[model samples]
Structure formats: C-alpha cells, structure tokens
Target chain A: MSSTINLFMAAHHKECDELFAQAEQAVSEGDWEDGLFRWQAFADELEKHFTREEQILFPEFEQATGMTGGPTQMMRMEHEQMRSLVNEINKVGTARDMDQFLGLSESLMVTMQQHNMKEEQILYPMTDQSLTNAQEIIERMNQ
Target chain B: MNLHKLSLDTIPPILTPFRFFLSALLFGVLAALLLLYSREDFWFTRWSNSNLALTHLLTIGFMLMVMMGALYQFIPVMNGQLIPGSKKLAPVIHVLMILGVLALVSGFLFSNSELFQAALAALGTASGLFALSLLPLLISRLGNQLIVYLLRVLFLVLLITLGLGLFLLLGHALPELNLPYRFYTDLHVLWGLAGWVVLIIMAVSSQVTPMFYVISEFSPRYLKILSLLIILTLVVMSFYTVFISKQSGTDSAQPFIYYTLAFLLSAELLVFVFYTLLKIAQRKRKIADVTINFYRLSMFSLLAALMLWWVAVFLPLAHLTYLLAILLIYGLAISIINGMLHKIVSFLIFLHLQKLSLKRPEAMTLVPNMKQVISTRNSQIQFMLHLLSGSLLLISVHYPALTVLAAVFMLANFCWLSWCLFQAYLLYLESRKKILACPEISMSL
Candidate 1:
C-alpha cells in the first residue's frame, strides 16, 4: 500500500514526455540524427511504461476490482493507437522527411499527453486503491 | 479510484459538434454579408435596427450555436456521463436554433411584428429544449469540481438570459407590454456574455490547454478565486438592476454599476488571455500548427480588445464602443472558436478512426491518419484569410468602405473553412464505408 503508484507512474510518464520533447525540438531544428536518437529513447521508455501497466499493474488492478473493461481498457487501446503513430514517426525519421516527421510527431505528442492525463488522473489513482500489495508491485515495476 | 465511473463510451456521435461548427461558418459569412448591405447609420449606435440584426446574427447565430454544440461534447468528457436523449434532441435543437436566429434577424431588420412573434416562439423553444437536453447530464456526478460548479451556474444563467431576451422581444412582438426594452436588453447581454460564454471558456481552458497541448497545468486555486469574483460581480450588478434602479429613478447610478462590472469583467478576461498566452509560449511542442496560430491570434486579439476597452474609460472617442465590441466578439470569441475547431475536429476524426480500425483491423488500411484528416497547409491558408479579415474589420470603423474588404476576407475564410471540413468529412465517410464492408465488427471497448 505504500508503493506510491501515482507518483512513480507519473514520474515515468514525465520522463517519457521529456524525451519526446527533446526529439520534437531536434526535429524542429532540422537535426534528424539527434531527433532519431532522442525519439528512440522516448519510444523505449514508453514501451517499458506500457509493459509495467499491461504485464503487471493492469492485470493486478483488474483482478482486485474484477472489472475487465473500463478506463484501463480505454488506456490500452489508446496506447495501441500511439504505438502505431510512433511507428510512423520512426519511419519518417529514417527517411529524413523533416516535414513529415514533425507532423507525425505533433500528432503523437497530443495523443500521448491526453492518454497520460487520463491514466494519471483516473487509472493510477484506481490502481493505488485497488491493489493491496502495491509496495511489491512497485518493486517489480522498478525491476 | 473512480475509474468505473469514467468511460470512453460516453462521448456523443462525431456529427453532433460538427453540425454546429458548419452552421457557425455559414452564419459568419451571413453576418459579414449583412453588414455589407446595411446603411451607414446602422453602425452609429448600438440600438440601430440593422446593427441589432447584425449583432444577433453573430452572437446568437454563430457564437451561441457553436457553444451549445461544444457543451454537448464537453459535458460527457468532463462529467463522464452521456446526456440523455442527446442523439434525439441535437438535430431538433439545431433546426430550431437556425430557424429562430433567422427569424429574429429578419424581425429586427424590417420591424415586422409577425416576424418578431415567430422569432420569440422559435428561439424560446430552442433555448428551452437545449436546457432540457443537458438536465440529465448536469445531475450526474461530475469528476472535475470546478467544471461541475461552472456548468451548473452557466446552465441556469443561460435560461435567465433567454427569458430576459424573451421579455424584451415581447414588447416588440405584442406592443402591449410597453417595457423599457433597453433596460432589460443590457441585462440579457450581460448574462449571455459574462455568465454563459466567459465562464464556460474559463472552465474548459483550465483543463484542456494543459492536457491537449502539453502545456503546464494552471493553478486551480487562481481559477477558483476568479470564479468567485465573477459570481460576486454578477450578483452585485443584478441586485443593482432589479432593486436599486427603481428606487433612484435616475440614469446616473446605472452607468456607475455598469462601468464597475465592465471593468471587473474585462480584468478577469485579461487574466485568462494572459495565462493562455504564457501557456502557449511554454508549450512543449515547438512545431508550427494552424491551431497554434489561431490560439496566439485569439490571445492577442483578446488582449488588444481589453486594452482598447481600458483606454476608452479615460479618453472619449467617437464610435470607440463599436470598435471595442468588434474586437471582443469577433476578434476574441470567434477567433478562439476557429482555433478550437481545428483541434476538436481533428481529435474527433482521429479518435473515431482509431476506434473503427480497432474494431476491424483489416479496415485500417483504408483509414487516413490524423494529419491527413485536415491538412496543415489548407488550414494555414484559412488562418491567413481570417487574420486579414479581422485586421480589416478593426479599420472598418473609421472608413465604412473598408467593411466591404473585410466582408470579402470573411467570405474567403469561411469558404475555405467549409472546404477543409468537407474534405475531412468525406474522408470520414470513406473510412466509415470501408469499416462497414468488413464481415464482422468487434464490438469492444
């Protein structure tokens, strides 16, 4: 119960957001190399965050609450949508299509941010409440 | 912990808000064209016959239309409850409102009693039905406390505004009431602008700008304070109008209370504009967007309007009030609405398409991404036309002939806006057909 699910997950979201912003800034400056590097870091961090939710947190929360389709379901769906966008961004980055990359990146950034808001505001708080063994879950998520 | 209370299923159909958006563009073009044909003397006073018609065409015809549609969409997002009978009521209200505003405008323009009566019936019914549609959702447990509070007040205030407007209209329609039409009309304007429009915009911006654009969240404490000041000012103004005015029987006290509330209202709006500007300046994304252009222009226009309004308090200038009204209504309000359309329309298209693709992955190949729904280049051109129109409008006050140029700009801007949305809608239709052609759709969250 002392795992601090909201703060820990929220901080990870912030980390991903910061990386995304750096990638975005690089693309804006027409530095495709830096853009790709930062974007890869952001994508990797995002995948880890998704794994923590999908593999550990969401299953645990669903089991505790016995609710399969709800906010988490929506979040998972949005994450899929974002993952596709990330793929498009990666494709454009490789092609060095600056205009295309910037456009796709802006779209991705909006989707990601709104998704984070919903998770941070609704899902994480619910996870904190429903999961009794939150401290262990946090340790596992950290790992 | 309230995740069960929130669901993405609560959102209304995509067409609900788009219907209003398209109508607003039509009305904007109409309002501009109406200004072109009106006599030169119409701009001389606030109460001139044609001026009344023109103003209502913009305020009721355009602004109110868009706001109602947005509320239907916003309530579900902010409250997590779909409004009961919304699908059934939205189209009905839209038709009623369009008919009502047209009737009202023609009545004002021609001084026809029959048209005034028709206007009363149409507008009154439309406003009532609009309120009825929101009743169920308003009673639900809203997640955001600030938005919940503001919406409750805004709903009530909208009815009050409509009721007062009806009272004034009756004097013109029936001619038996013999009311001081101007007296009640001012109160009607106050509640409409300050109570409904300003409050809702403030409440939405408090959450939306932060989330959608990745801007830093504003201090809710400051918003709470601003809300209180707004309510207090409205209460004082109402108290003065309803009670104190009859006792004094003089025009002197009216101007004092009016100016005081005006100052306080503008100050609150200035704070909103200032905060929005800062948020945009510090937004995480540095890439150029048509929506960002609209937002920046909206803030600057709002600030410019407030500054001009402040200057008029000390210096006397002819028709300065008209200029101030232009900037506040068209410059600030319409500009923000345009900015919001770019984002909201795109978001809806993007969200719905994703949902469709999720339902049938095979149909995804036919789906266009968000960036392709409404192209940046097309909207940028739309924004340029808007900027040119707005600038010409400001200068149109001194030289009446310039209004023709402004009208031309407005016509082009609106035509482009309509074209952009039409293209997106066509894309939506194509994607929708592809999804339907699939054998089985996965009906899941």
Candidate 2:
C-alpha cells in the first residue's frame, strides 16, 4: 500500500513539474495560446488530484487518524488561490498582451514549482508512513 | 498534483478563528483611522505620498492582513496541508505589519521626515518578510496551477510596488539624492493598484465566487489567461505611457490609456458579476443567508458603479467621478468585505466549535449557528447608511460641509460593525467555555 501511494504521488509530482516547464517555455516564446492551454492542463491535473484526495484519500486518513481540520483545510485554501490565479491568467490571455501574460506566467511558475516540491517532499511520505492499510486502499481507489 | 497524506494534528494555530478576530480588529481600526484622516480635496487627486500611505493602510494593513490570517486558517482545511511557519510567523508578521502601517500612515500625514523614512523601511522589511515566510506554504501547493499563478503574480507585483514606494520615500526624505520623484511615483501607483491590488482581487474572486455560490467551476483556461492579460496590459500600458509622457512632455496618452484600462477592467468585472449572479440563481440551497444577500447587493453595486464609471469617462463630470469612486470603494469593496467577514468569522467559529466538540461531546449544543453571530438588521442599517453617506458625500464635494455628516455617519457605522464583531467574539468565548467544562459529554463517540 505504501509503495503504491509513493509511486502515484511521485508520478503526480513529475507530471506537475512537466506542466510547469511547458508553461514556462510557452510564456517565454510568447505563444499565449499554448501557454494558456498548458496552464489549463496543469490546473485540470491539480483539480483532479485534489478531488481524488478529498473524496478518496482524505476520508481514509481521517478514519485512520481520528483527526480532522488540519492539512486538508490548508490544501483547500491553496486550491482557492490557484483557482483564482488560473482565472487571472485566462483573463490576461484573452487580452492577448504579452507583458501581462509573461508577468502573470512568471509568478505562476515560481509558485507552482515551489508548491509541488513541498508536497513531494513532505506530505506524501508522511502519509505513506502513517497509513498501514495502504495496499487495500490503493486497490479500492483503482477499482 | 500529488495527493499527500497529512494528519489533523498538523494544523497551525495561527489559522484558528481567534487569530482571525485579532487580525480583523487590527485592520478595522487602521481602516477607520484612514477614513477619519483622509482629505476629500486630496482623495484620489493623483496618488501622492498621503494617498500611497492611506491606500497601503487599507490594502496592506486592512486587506492583506485579514487575507493572510484567513489564508492561514483556510489553506489547511482546503488542502489537507499545514502551513510551515504559521504558528510563530503569523504573530511576527502581524506585529511587523501593524507597526509598519502606523509608521507609514503617520509619516505620510506629517510629510517627509526621519520618522517617515523609518516607517517606510519598517513596512518594506515587514512586507518582504511576510512574503518570504509565505514562500514555503505557497511552494507546497504548487500543483494547483491557478493558485500558484495568482500568488506569484501578486507577490511579484507587491515587491515592485513596495520597492518603488521605498525609493519615493527615500527621495522625499533626502532631496539631495535628486531622484525623479514623479517617475517613481507613477510606477509605484501602477504596480500597487494594477499589479498587486487588482490581480490579487481577481485571483481571489475566482475561488470565492464559485465557493460562495457552489457554481460550476469557472473555465480555468479562459479565466486564467483573461485575468493575466488584463493586468499585464494595464501595467505595461501604464509604464509605456509614463515613459512617453516624460519624452513628449505635453502628451495626453496617459489619460487615454487610463481610460482604456478602465474600460477593459469594467468589462472584466461585468463578466465576473454575470457568472457569479448566474451561479447564485442556480444555487441548490433555497434558504438564502445574510452573507449571500450582502454579496448580491455588492455585485449590484459593482455593476452599477462600473457603468457609472464608463458614463463619467465620456461626461467627465466631477460629481459623477465622485459618485463612482464612492460606489466602488465604499459600496462594492466594503459591502463585499462585510459579507465575507460575516461568513468567514461564523464559519471559523463553527469549525472551532466542531473541533472542540470532538474532544468534549457534551458541549455539542453550545455550538452556535452562523446566524447568531451575524446580525442582518445591523448589516442592513450599515449598508443603507453607507449608501446614503456616499451619495451625500458625492454632492458634498462641492459643498464640503456635507462631508462632515458623511464622516460622522461612517464613524457610527464603523462603531456598529465593531460592536457586532465584539459581540460575536463574546458568544464564541462563552461557547468555548461551555464546551471545555463539559468535555467528557462533548467528546465524539
């Protein structure tokens, strides 16, 4: 179970990084169409990731730990911030202004890269260690 | 987009309801002070030292402070992750931000002096530190493209804005340096207003609008690109015009760009308002809360004000401009803040109480409904008074005496808001005490 969770989380991290890099390249080239597309893909992956956690993983953790109102809450707020920025980026893209797109993209890239590092380093490992019944849970998630 | 595991115990203390109350009170007092001291003659008369000081007091002191506290508490619940430095750093950031605000406000009111320079330095350092501390928390959640983007944009803009402000302050303090004050000031306002303030608002609105209404999530692709484009255009156009003005000396291009940006911003705001209203109309929850009502009213005011602004652009009437500013600042912004505060405070209290009840099951009854904490009647009265005061003040710009009455009414409204919040806090304390006393009974089985 632990290994499966680790594998999935690691894969997720790499995907996020790739998206970030793609977004950076697109913005640098001033190809806002591609930049916007990559950003949306990045956001979509994140939204799916969060949904899976909230619906599948978080409940299991809550049941196992008998604790609530901690990391889950923080993640939700961060999601809100990310969602807002995505909206802002899209707005800038529509205006088709390179400076605005780049300025926003620059900030988004830094924030996204940093955020991915933290999750990959800390949260995933912590979860893997704590959840003893991870194999069953992973199988259930797959099903 | 890693689904990391985290335990409930990892939640930070600074993200609790108590800290929110503390931040809110501090910001409220500072905002009130700005309102009391602000001169109508100089209000929006071109972003001067005093204007910058007052604006920062509202944006950094009031808005950002509240936002940080809310974010600290909220992020944990949203993401299942704890903020790394929330416990120790929250208070440190809060105190520094408060002191910085005081220094900047006093310095601006008094004009160029050693104290002003010290205040600017304190504020700049505190803001820098706050941004630094937020880096870890921000980094942890980078999987979410939308939030990561917003934070990055806001932080960068904040840095530029603050840096320019510091330069301007230094120039004022030491005139012998011979810095081009006008140039820096223009850039500073541009970064501060367009870059930091508007971008953050836009970023926050995307999440808030959907969450509040439970609407279908905004089309991420369109929203993200659109917001970035608008802010970027405004910022670049502002700097470009400024550069052009310096070269041409008698150019009106700056005003033209300003008008264009305003129109663009208004259009964007309209889109936001429409989406929000549409969602609200479709909300499954039939029973409307006070916060939702206030939110709806705020949206109406925002739309009306935007239209008025466009009209005034063509008409160029002083009265119309004053009216629009009042509607935008006092009407739309304040209304939204009021609504948000009511909901956020109540939700925080509920979350805290729920947590407490987990340990002490007997005190479950003590947890108050959100309605008890927020008084709709009081909010309604305050909103009406604000509208009345705004209308009167707009007319009173010509008849300056009327501003006194507007100020008086505003003071009363602020007092009422403070009282309501205080009352809510008291209720929260009482509820906590009851829960603590009956711990065994309140514990979750």
Candidate 3:
C-alpha cells in the first residue's frame, strides 16, 4: 500500500477537499468574508500539496523509472494549468464575483479530482512497487 | 503497467464519444417517431410489436450506444489505462450494435423469426468483440477494489445476459432445435436490468457524482452493499427460476421468489436513491447548472420507479409494467446518461482545447470556457423538454392519444440535445482550425 507515501499524499487531498467544500458552502450562502478566508487557506494548502508532488514524488519517480516524458510530464503540464487557474482565482479581488469564483472553483475541483485520481490510483502504487527505500524518500520529503 | 494509459493519449480523439452521443440522440428521436407511429399499440400492450420496438430503440439503440462511448472515454481516466484498439474498433462495434438493435426492433415489429435470428447473431458477435477488445484493458487496471471489482462483474454479467438472451431467441430462430427452460427469459431480464444496469450506474456514479458536482464521496459503503444486494438477488432469483423449476417442473417456481427478489432489489434502490438525493441536497455548489438539474431529475425518477416497483409486486395493476419500464429505463438510466453527456462532452471539449491552446499559444484567445461550449439556454430547453416528455409518457399509459404528444416532446428534447452537442463540436472545430492556421508558435500535441 505504500502506507507512508500513499496515505500521506492522499490525506492532503482529503484535507484540501474538506476546505474546498467549506469555501464553496460559504460562497453559495453569499458569505464573502468567510469564503475568502477558507478559500485562501485551501489555495495555500493546495499549493503545498502540489509542491510536495512536483518536487519530491515526481522527481523520485522519474529517477527510478527513467521515464521522463510520460505520465509525470503530463502531470506537470496539468499542474501548470491548475496553477494558472488558481492565479486567476486569486485575482477576483474584494468585490465578490461569486459566479466567476464558483465557475473557476468548479474547474479547479475537476482538475484536482482527475490529477489526484491518477496519482493515487496509478503513480503511488507504481512508486511503492519500484522504490527500494520509500520510507527514506518519504522522510526526506517530509523534511 | 502500460504507463501510456495514464497520459492524454489514452483519451481518444473527441469524435470517439461524440459520435456515440450524436448517434444516441438520433436513436432517441427515432424512438420518438416510432412511438408516434405506433401510438396505439405502444400504450395498449407491453409485449406487443410496437412496444417491444420502442423499448429496444431506447434501451439498445440509445442507452447502450451512449454507454459504449462513455465507457471508452472513462475507462482510461477511471482506471489509468486505455482500452486497447479503442480507436480502430469503435466504428466497427458501433455499426454492429446499431444494426443488431435495429434487427431486434424489426424482428419484434414484424414478428419475423428470421430477423430475430439476425439480431441474435449480430448482437452476440458485437458484444463478444466488445468484451474481447476492451474488458482486458479495463481488468488489468484493477488498482483498487469495490467499484472496479463491481464493474468487472457487471461486464461479465452483461455477456451472460446476452448469451442467455441469444439462447432464448434460438428456439424461435430455429424451430428445429428446441431448448428447454422457458424461464431463461426472466433470468435474462433480471441480469440485464438489475445486475448490469443497476451495478454499472452505481459504480460509475460513485466516482462521477462526487467529481462533477463537488460533493464529498457520499455512499461507498452503502453503494457497495447496494451493488452486492442487486447481484445477490440476481443470483438467488436465477437459482430459483432455472434450477428449482427443473426440480418440480413448471409448477414449482412460485410468484413468491419473484416477490422476494423484487422487494430486495427495490429496497436497495430506495436506499441508493435517497443517499443520492441527500448528497445533491447537501451539495456545496448551488449554481443550478443543467447537469445538476439532470442529476436531481434522475434521482427522483429512480425514486418513483423504485416505489412503483414495490407496488407492482403486490398488485398487478394495469400499465404497471409500462410505468416501471418508463421510470427505470427512460426516467433513471436515460436521464443520467443525458446529464453525463453534457458534462463529459463539455469537459472533453474544454480539455482538448486547453491542451491545444497550451501548445499553440496564439490560439489561446480562441479557446472557450465550459459554458461557451454549450449555452445554458439550450440545455435548459433540453431539460425542460425532457421533463415534458417524461410527464406526458407517464400520462400516456391512460390516454393513448397523449402518446403522440409524449413522443413529440421526447423527440423535441433529443433534437435540442443533439443541437447542443453539435454546437460544442463546432466550437471545438473552430478552435482547432484557428490553432492549426497559426504555425508560428506550435508546440507538439
């Protein structure tokens, strides 16, 4: 199961999902202040999660597999798309354009769901199987 | 382990699924026209020529066609692998299925045993090729349990259902070779409606409902049980019908087994529907998109069918069979498919365009958002038309004249649906043309 690697990474997704729902709930109810606060927290957590994968897991995977222009490359490109989406979301400013926010937020959700599904279902298990010292890798990434 | 499965390449060109969607829409309209043509027989009898034809039109012609497309599109993303030969084999599979279903419809309409034989041969061959071509790819990606496992089971059951059905048609096809066990018909229907249809919908929705609607994962435990209960009921009923019927001849098989199976299946469906409604109610996003509206409508239709299914077991009410068929087949299954068609098509269009725009930066401005891909007004009209047809069809059971009106509404709904999807296609084409023209800033796709 690659308990450390898979669970640790997937838990971040669960955490981000919770915050995302909270922000969405707030916005749907037209609570801008709370919505912004929760949304910011979600964005920050999401960035951290993305960084963890991009820097640590994907590199370790690429090194082990030596398949540079494959799944990981696609993941990086999708990350770029998501990051650009997050950037646009951040620019919504103080005047709450709830419709646009929700629209883009929906996009972010789909992007994240697809990205996370591939990572959890495909990449993590593969990494778990191939890596000689996953715990050490996890420890290094944790640091 | 084929890492290529996880990449965008696994996602076939848009036409793969769009063709299926467009065909399903056309078939839906065809079903409507058939309904209008056979308005008298359609309302009068469930097993009559026109009624049987209409059911096939909706079931095999429309629903299965669309499902084949969606399965191809989603298998990769869902399992992190592409179905082998998905691109090349699709057209062949599509033609066979369309021809097979049309033959079945004609066989029923004309009471022609020859057409029945033709349908069995065509459909069996098509489904056999379908399984051989695609199931292996999906099976190899069994990275997780429960949902994936259920999907695998459903695929097998689907093949069995087709085989059993073909077996039944054989006696009629060739009067020279007689096969025993007349009750295989009930077994085939049990597997098709309960096992295959119910399980696949539950399995797909477990992932999709949460992903598309931004709802949390709602019903894993219950969904797993619901799927299992449906299968268990199917197996139990099959045993009671086939094996037990042999034990004491025709008299041994009682209505009680049928009664118990119906109750068990209907109860599980009730839980599933309620759980779905709960999630939709608790959904965080409340913008009221057409897809969301479709989801709500689908759940309610399922709920209505489930309730009526329960009642139909106790009292054999007139038109009860037709009512349940409409509710289950058209109301629940078709509505969900129609709802997903919008999301899958729109998302796929946006995805390819996004990928294209990334490569050819000059075409960035030409790229469309999800909304622009299909106008809200168009989908709203489609949904309303869908609701209108469903209502009129429900009423047509009592008044046969309204069957024509119901068919009109259903046909109109599908026409709008086809138009909406075509618009998305044109938008995609426009993006492609503009992107291809600008060769200056080309990145390899």
Candidate 1's docking class is acceptable
RMSD to the hidden true structure, all candidates: 2.8, 14.0, 3.1
| Residue-by-residue lDDT tens digits, candidate 1, B305-374 | 7788788888877777688677767776777787777777776777777667776767755656666788
In model 1, residue pairs whose N, Cα or C atoms come closer than 3 Å (at least 3 residues apart or on different chains), thus clashing, are none
lDDT of 3 by residue, B338-406 (tens): 878877787888778777767665665566666667656777887888888999999988788788899
Score chain A of each prediction against the true chain A by TM-score and list the results: 0.95, 0.79, 0.92
Assess candidate 2 and give its TM-score to the true structure. 0.70
lDDT of 1 at B254: 71
Local distance difference test scores for all models:
0.77, 0.62, 0.77
TM-score for every candidate vs. truth? 0.91, 0.70, 0.90
Fnat per predicted structure, each in turn: 0.31, 0.07, 0.29
lDDT of 2 by residue, B338-399 (tens): 66776666555654664566545456456664545555566576567656655665566667
lDDT of 1 by residue, A48-89 (tens): 999999999989998999888876787788778888878877
Sort all candidates by TM-score, best to worst.
1, 3, 2
lDDT of 3: 0.77
A62, model 2: CA deviation in Å?
A: 10
Question: Considering lDDT, which of the candidate structures 2 and 3 is the better prediction for this target?
Answer: 3
- The deviation in Å at residue B404 for candidate 2 is 1.4
